[model samples]
Target: MATFATSEQLLVIIDPAARQTDGESVRIAKDVLSAGAATKVCLPDGPEEFARALGRRGSRRPVVIGDDRALVRAVTVLHRARELAGCALSVVPVGDTALAESLGVPRGAVAAARAVLDGSERRLDLLVDDSDGVVLGGLGIPPEPVRAAAPEPVTAAAGRTWYRSLVRTLAPGRPRLPAVPSPGPSRLRVEVDGAAVVDLGQPVEAVSVAPGTGGLARVEVRPLSVGAEATPVRACGQTVTVIGADFRYRADAAVSGPVRRRTWRVAEGAWGLTLPTGS
Candidate 1:
């Protein structure tokens, strides 16, 4: 880990969508970071501008102020710039909390900012797709229903606001399993490191690949559930190949493919991040 200079600057990128919904919190985060040691706050209007600002990040630490999507975007830019290997990236999560919580970032803005000021740098694995794009978290094939079921902007806001209270009240009435109409699984041929692993015509509901221990890749296949427990197929490899009919997949929340084949290779510890302790 590189030791940051005492007078090092900090660049902040706030997501545009987040700003529209909750600009005050964004402003508060900026104020707190600015008041901290040798930090400068930057508010990029959009992703393109954010990339431009980050391209010149230099020796200053970069702090992202938005949801998980925004954090992923920042990491992508830094990785492309080849700065991620040396620079520490921090995130002040806003909007959706799922990804941030999984990554161990604090929920509140003030606490997240404090984390930025007092955090250790660590090397985290980044998934690079066939296109050479980096994914911060695990990628999914045939994206989760929740992502596809996202409502309109206004409706989504209302849903999130009332989701907790509504779920609490209706928990007992809700069915344990969702009435998922079985989209019969398409045939897929999977190979790990150029060797065949799974060659079946079963219903593959979803497939995902993530980094495992010792820099090996862990591949998981979730076939259509026959019983209560969905059989999980796991494999370890350096390279993964998936060939099937046109099917879309979510790579770190962003939808990617409908192609016949996609390959993913493990780029171990390709980037570094500045995160709260025990993240």
Candidate 2:
């Protein structure tokens, strides 16, 4: 674990979303941070400028003042540039903070900004996909159920509403596998560290994977059943792969995919986060 030095120089990148969503919070964070340390602030207008700001960050510590998406975007940029290991990341929660709080950062502008100035840096695990994307929280297959709840007559509209509800329940928290979706199943092949956990012959209600201890990932697959609830098959491994008909997944707070196959490998302690001392 790397230790952060007090009074370290900072490169503060305030995401546009943060500014738009909660200008007051953003202002408070800025005021507190600038008052304590030598800080350089960058206000990027869009994704391209955001990436550019991070790419050019030299020796200063990068502190993101934004929501969960902004935090993810910062990490993604640093990871892709191969510079993630060199610096500790800091975030001041603005707008959505589920992912930040889950990772142990203090909530609110004053508290989080204080963390930026006085916190310690701790290494954390993350998932890196074959496509170079990263997952800081849980990943859920299908994101939501595609089937209607049993006991209720199935209808296209009902299925949509039910699925949306299912997705909402899997809110971000400490990185862990998400719960199986309610009742609907899709055919998929799931493998962990090269061993098959489930195959295409069996339909699955849902699949989830998240970073786990010892540089591995926790995987769970809920197989479809007829008259009874199917027990979720679970596994832990350094790598997880999923394949089948075009499938979508929710990683952290973002929903992505429709791809036939995707593989994720655990990168243990791949990044550092600034948190309260002794956290």
TM-score of each: 0.81, 0.85
Task: Encode model 2's per-residue lDDT on 1-279: one tens digit a residue.
Answer: 556676678999999877765666788999999999999999998899999988888888999999888899989999998998887899999866888999999998999999888888888999999999999988998785333324323358747445533533454322333543543578999999999999999999889999887899999998887898889999999999999998889898787877999999999999999999888
lDDT of 1 at 132: 72
Superposed Cα RMSD, model 2: 9.6
Candidate 1 per-residue lDDT over residues 119-238, each given as its tens digit = 767676666768777666777776665433243233466465455335434544311223223245656777889986667667677778876655678888877787786878888888
Write down the lDDT that model 2 would get. Answer: 0.85
lDDT of each: 0.71, 0.85
Query: TM-score: which candidate is best?
Result: 2
Please list the Cα RMSD from the true structure of every candidate, rounded to 1 decimal place.
7.1, 9.6
The 10 consecutive residues of candidate 1 with the worst lDDT sum are 173-182
Report the lDDT of model 1 for residue 191.
85
Q: What's the residue-level lDDT of 211 in candidate 1?
A: 67
**Per-residue error at 49 for model 1, in Å?**
0.8
Q: Which parts of model 1 have CA positions greater than 4 angstroms off?
A: 1-6, 147-183, 225-230
